[model samples]
Target chain A: MTDQATADLWPGERTEAARRLLLAAVESFARRGYHATTTRDIATGAGMSPAALYIHYPSKAALLSEISRTGHRATLDLVEGAEAASGEPVEQMRRLVEEFTAWHARGHTVGRIVNNELHALPEDAFAEVAELRIRIEDTVRRIIEKGVARGEFEVPDSRTAARAVTSLGIDVARWYTDRSTESPEELGRRYGVLVLRMLGSAAA
Target chain B: MTDQATADLWPGERTEAARRLLLAAVESFARRGYHATTTRDIATGAGMSPAALYIHYPSKAALLSEISRTGHRATLDLVEGAEAASGEPVEQMRRLVEEFTAWHARGHTVGRIVNNELHALPEDAFAEVAELRIRIEDTVRRIIEKGVARGEFEVPDSRTAARAVTSLGIDVARWYTDRSTESPEELGRRYGVLVLRMLGSAAA
Candidate 1:
């Protein structure tokens, strides 16, 4: 596994073994998808036995839930962090788009599973992740709302505009490849400028 | 299956049984993903035997290839059709975004599979679909180029702009649900306006 992959696992995961299992699950899920990946596959990828896998994660679903929850929380924290960093609405949005888009590009494998594989999550786990998703959306909407209030941006519908911005960032995971010449930071800067134009900010 | 679902199948599929199998594959791939779904599951969904399914599609990969090829072709046609119908660049872009985004929203199940499941296709089939994807991107890029040439749009990088626009539309499939209060047409219109602003269009 690449050091980047190892670093992307939930930093709060206390045990090295559990972090290894989570990284293994992400690789298997990203390669074969959540439904196709088996507990044995994850264990094999991690160089552990299925029985040993149970010590870290009770089931495949639990592993997925933990990944989903951690990924969503990271995204939420990124957006909120960007929001808190800037007093200006345009700068806040730029930071939000830049960091958020870069996060997706950098951790695209985890982002793909977090955004796409939640359907496989158990009900309560799914709900927990859904709540985080809502917060992310609402946070973006609130940013746009503040922009409109300050007359720094013009949008007829804050909700849809927020969705479009978030969608642009989220879909980076769908298509980003290491073969691409652009770095994640470059892609993030490009998207940040485009998003300003998208929001009708004069600063664009 | 719903009438809309049946109608979305490749109309050129000559036999009724072939269309049934194709539709079943789309539904199965969308719900369980391409990797987890089996030919047996597809045949069962279509009310046919596995042996009977082979009479039409040679393999599950074949079914997925046909779906991906057909869906990509339709998108190409849609983008080209919009381009053909408009002489003005701004109008051309509006129509492109509206139709393209609405198509993804309406056929989200097939859209999801066509966009996300192509990784499961055999190498030759994946190459074939990749060619179509490149054409779609090129066509959109050409439209933006025309807009830039006429000074109807101002974008520092047309290629990335095209990518962001297409990304916005394609992602509708990931998040769109019947539960959404916005209809596909309305969502498309909303995106149409947002895309104009994104492109730095004076018409916006």
Candidate 2:
């Protein structure tokens, strides 16, 4: 089953049917990757006939588009929420790294689908997702810019630092697993300090 | 067409027939990805029949395995060569980041196929590639460790910092483009500084 935070992002869609179908698609896309996974495979994984899948998603690309759009919205919300929280720049960054890294690590299956399956979305959907991604990057970049202006951070370039910090967190989806000893929270804590240090902030 | 560095990596096999097939595989796999590409497509791209593809590669998976293995070895060699060059730890780190990032950016098509298509590799081959990957990580980690030990770098965690640094470069493959106006050399120079700062080294 998916975690509470990830599930909560899709509120009002908890009808049992949609949940099973979406969850099945996420797992299949994560395991076999988006290109290799078929709609029939997703339907079978969800214990449904192949014909039943179309009633919900219309097509495999539609399923991917929906997932990507939802994931991007959730990510944008998470980053923006962290950015808007009441705090000094340092505190804001720590919270941002913690939430971003933990989200990628804890909900890694969906994270993989969201991050790695972008190419699978139809052209129209990809444009929308790209705009959302730009907003997400801008949010992080603004935080870093504020930190530099406040003299709370001293990176050579705020934009590049933002990109590196984000890349550090997004990569958790590629490598994190339950078998690892580090919990999502623990990884978040570690990365928060590491990333802050990268920005020339002293460790907390 | 692939870049000169990528082409030169596969020297001694530059016979006309082999070059066309291999280059076509790299481009197709990079564009459409491995699972989505059929041998037929690759053959057509190379100006050969589908059956003719078998004369060079036993199967489509074999083609992927060859590309993945060759790419991994090439990457491993590149990173190791950078690390082993004579310099202080900080300078070594700079070279490593510059070369590594430039390679990923310049050869991003092959880089995508090599880094993103790992799951398409067969089990035994994956194990070998995995070992090479470990060595590559170790090479970077050891440089950071030496830097920390010698007081040349002051990272809270060498292993985590190395992972972050590598993740930063690997991500260029996902996002870099010639149309972006940031040349590979410029990107490499910028990243080299960011990574050194991450390691607590002063700018090179």
Which of the numbered candidates is closest to the native, going by highest TM-score?
1
Could you tell me every candidate's TM-score relative to the true structure?
A: 0.97, 0.93
Please, what are the lDDT tens digits per residue for candidate 1 over residues A34-87?
A: 999999999999899999999989999999998888889889999999999989
What CAPRI grade goes to candidate 2? medium
Considering every candidate listed, which one attains the maximal DockQ? 1
- Candidate 2 per-residue lDDT over residues B1-204, each given as its tens digit: 676656765788666766778888887876776777888888999999988888888887887777778888988888888877966788788998999999888887787777777877899889989999899899899899988889888876677777777877887877776675678887888788777777877553
Please list the residue runs of candidate 2 whose C-alpha ends up more than 4 Å from where it truly belongs after superposition.
A1-12, B1-5
Error of 1 at A28 (Å): 0.5
The 10 consecutive residues of candidate 1 chain A with the worst lDDT sum are: A1-10
Candidate 1 per-residue C-alpha lDDT over B26-105 given as tens digits, one digit per residue, 9 for 90 to 100: 87887788999999999998999999999998999999988888888889999989989989889989999999998888
Report the lDDT of model 1 for residue B94: 98
Scored against the true structure, residue A124 in model 2 reaches a CA lDDT of 98
